[model samples]
Target: MRNPAFGHRADRTLPRYFYVLRNRDGEARLPVYWEPRPASRDPLVREVYRVRVAGRTLEAGNLHVLGDRLRDALGSLLATGQPPRFWLVNGACASPVYREGEAYVALTDGPRLWGKDLAELVGRYAHYLASCNGGRRAPVSVALFSPADLDVHWPELVWTGPGVWIPVFGVDGRLTAFGPRDRTWSVPAGPGAVLELWERVGNDLVACGLLQHPAALWGSEVSDSTRGALLASSEPTGLTLRFVHFHPSGAGRVTLPIRRLEGRVFASCGELSCLHVAPDPGTLREYLSAHLAQAGVVAGLQDVVLEEDGGASLHRLVRAERLPVGLASSHA
Candidate 1:
């Protein structure tokens, strides 16, 4: 009888691979090896990469993609130290066999190819890959999804409603947008953990009343004493939205109803008091910087007056500069 684990093959010489599966005991380190075919039958496909593990062989078009897949499989084995029922890989669904191959690579324990799940995975991958390609900046494009879609698809992230795009920041102080949305977003390599942090910050802003629904029309303005009380409390119930202006010099000044903002009054004075609050900038800035360097948000807080109902109303501000091109107009 032929060995079920080994495929009938003619291998000239191929490289083998191994990695230490770290454990408390440090007794076992499984060696993994695969032979790359010289070339693929299909002209477009450069080559075929195969990886055999746990009695299953998997193949992918590119070496890096296969490497990532193997890394994920090894990670799972290390966590439980037991052979999983099926190997898990992104962009795939549960099926008897993965892709069109004789290799019995069963992928029966991965996320279903639901529209929502696929979009999220695509967005994450796109973000990750784009960020990895050096420091070149690119325009951001975000698909608008309804509130219902957000609730169903991304319960962890918050959406304040249509036309209100969440801002994602980068190390260069540039802004981008990513949130719960319909359709797939083709993001590169690994937005991964950073994107998730951005979403959590957005949700916190909404919860703290810094991000309000545009349709609310009436701003959730609060008194100075009330704002102070809210900030002091462990669970702040402040619905008081605030605004800021960003100067060319990268300094942020906030509009405050009170004469002195955080005890520092600015020399330049107007109806819209753009005061540079020292030491402490207030709740919005505090929330934005909650994750420190990982958050990627800038630390400037200038206030602005919003015209509403033929009167000036103070509302929380998110810069249109940060939103994806052509999306800012929707808020108008």
Candidate 2:
């Protein structure tokens, strides 16, 4: 009944470098670690406490910030008397992870949980992770999801990590994808708006039912109007845009390439080559401009447009600076 991970200890002895706070059931509710700053001149601060729940480093001189953060992270853990499903820690550096129903989703932006729908929430998390860590090989922070559906759909993509193949499986028996993941991409962020377009024409196929599943119109029951509307939806939308940094140094930039269109949340990722749906053309261009500028790749960017209807064809090319100056003028 008790989670052995927390251990059964009546006497709560503070460890050398880490502090463990247990709940009423004696389960480890919040375990925090820190390093002693002996040589520091400040008398008020003797050690830098590590809060490892958000997958980022937070060196606190005091416990106020640490307590506030831990309180939220430990809220559901205390009630359920279960340890975090997934924890990525490097010594005292750790981040908060929350268990949401069947999905053990991790939030990198902050402690608050956003999105009511499960798929949309996952979509947002995927969007955030890809934008931030798309260009880099080693990810500073990682979020997890239920690999049940992912494995059934994409099995070969699992366990493609670095050289050291230490098996780290998710809640399910096996994980869908885990590794230093990278998207197979042809378009590079250059000086111009590289609009890569794909038109769904000729025996146009429209996906129906749940957004997660990839079911076609052949068997799935759907109205003629719904199928027609989806087919007629103009332009290839950008679901996710990943801006790989030119120089792989310094702190990485976390981009959020998530948009809500027609009452649905659309997320984009360059790594996952195929998807059931995408955003409109206008929105995709808008996202690209912001994506390049934020990643600081606009100076040398060549705006390229590719239409993938009758095969991937180069539509046009324009220098990013030469484009009409409007919302993106400042960045150019």
User: If scored against the real structure, what TM-score would every candidate get?
Assistant: 0.20, 0.26
Give the Cα RMSD of candidate 1.
21.1
Q: Which ranges in model 2 have alpha carbons more than 4 Å from their true place?
A: 1-31, 62-65, 72-142, 145-332
Q: Which ten residues in a row have the lowest lDDT in candidate 1?
A: 145-154
> How do the residues 1-332 of candidate 2 rate in per-residue lDDT, one tens digit apiece?
22244343432234223335544334333334545678889976787665544233345776777667566754643444544433432234333345566444454545443433332333455455555566433323233422121111112111111121111222233222221111111222221101120111101112321122111101111223322333333223323333323332322222323343343322322222111122444444444444345446544223312223232111211111122223232221
Candidate 1 residue 60 Cα shift, in angstroms, is: 44
Best-performing candidate as measured by TM-score: 2
What lDDT tens digits, residue by residue, belong to model 1 across residues 64-98? 77768877865654353433222222233212212
Backbone clashes for every candidate come to 20, 26
